[model samples]
Target: MRLQDKVAIVTGAGSGMGRSIALRYAKEGAKLVVADLNLAAAQTVVDEIRDAGGEAIAIEVDVSDRVRAQSMVDAAAHAFGKLDVLVNSAGVGNIIPFLDTTEEDWDFVFDINCKGVLWCSQAAARRMIEQGRGGKIINLASQAGRRGEALVLAYCASKACVISMTQSMALALAPYQINVNAIAPGVVDTPFWDRVDAQFATLLGLERGEPKRRAVAAIPLGRIEQPEDVTGAAVFLASSDSDYMTQQTLNVDGGNWPG
Candidate 1:
């Protein structure tokens, strides 16, 4: 119970890495706010946590909306007693060639991946500062952030922003003892990747799974990553284990990218 009695909000907790982190936090004795753009999906995760005898509530939020983001923090404090951790996991991406990338593509991805994170972290940090209890903010970056890809310009840039933002946030929030860090995951087998794989297949004239296959083949771990593979790092970041750590973007990419 590394996170016993902690209150944590995990954005995009309806699915993939976010959902996994929420469930794991609950098991570790943290009360959870399972938030997602899709209320129903968030509720499903909340139900799962309750069924496992963990405390949790579902919240629907568009993290890019500052009002909604503020309300989300208010709701968490209202439901529980205080805020202790926030995992900014809500994000989006598209597989567009660099030349073909449009402003819409950039906005759609950046709005969620970057702006969303900013709003939520701001809201969460404010609450934490008011509470006077040092807290944790864990962001989801990507191996893609470390390098540019031929077909993922917007997404790559957005994640790179996340990493940079994490560093800046860590510095800004350090005065209040709020640790801000990020995890850069590699190719995980999640629904998000399903969309990515489909787009890559269509764009490159390859088989449906070919792009993903090639990605997995390149992982030094010798296997495709799973949502669960990232939960351990998420848990550590959210708990007291990382109290002395801040502004670090950890590579959870199975040696896919070197620092």
Candidate 2:
């Protein structure tokens, strides 16, 4: 019950890490607003939380849209009365080689990964500032952002933006007692990997699971990352435990990208 009586909005809560974070927050006594582009998936999470005796609602949202992102914040405040935490997890990645990366590829990834974070954070921060109490903003970064991967140039750049924005938001909102932070996850085995695997197969001339096999083999922890592996870091950030921390990117990558 670390988040007792708190209200939280988790973007991309439909699946993977976002879904895990939403459920974890609910378990901590926080009312949740599960936002995702997939209404059905978001509702599934809502059902899970409600079945567990926790309060939650689902909304369909494209975080890349500023107006839609603001509406999401408005809906949360309307439904739950106040917002205490925001987790931006909606993102995309492509595995084209650096030379093959196109402007459209960059736009697609950045729109959701970077621009989406900005829009959602802005909307959430406005509500938190008006509440006159501190709030937590957790963004999803990636190990790729700490360095560059030739195969995912656009994605790497976008996540770097996540880290940069986290720092900027932290400094800007510190005066208002709002904390902005990020979790840099690595090699998670979510449905997202299907896309990554397919892209790698096409671009790297590898088999469907070969790219993933190589990734898993490289993990120092001896296992691929799971969505649940990221929940603890998120729970800490959303709870009072991380009140003194901000503008920091916690590596939940199982010893990968230790930086």
Candidate that would win on TM-score: 1
lDDT of 1 by residue, 1-259 (tens): 8999999999999999999999999999999999999999999999999999999999999999999999999999999989999999999989999999988999999999999999999999999999998999999999999999999999999999999999999999999999999999999889999999999999999999999999899999899889999999999999888999999999998899979
CA lDDT of 233 in candidate 1?
96
Ten contiguous residues with the weakest lDDT in model 1: 234-243
How many backbone clashes does every candidate have? Answer: 0, 0
Show model 2 residue runs off by greater than 4 Å.
none
lDDT at residue 82 of model 2 (Cα atoms): 97
Query: Pairing residues by index, what is the TM-score of model 1?
Result: 0.99
- What residue runs in model 1 are displaced by over 4 Å at the alpha carbon? none
Error of 1 at 50 (Å): 0.3
Cα lDDT tens digits for candidate 2, 30-137: 999999999999999999999999999999999999999999999999999999999999988888888977889889999999999999999999999999998999
- Judge candidate 1 against the unseen true structure and give its global Cα lDDT, from 0 to 1: 0.96
Q: Model-by-model lDDT, in order? A: 0.96, 0.94
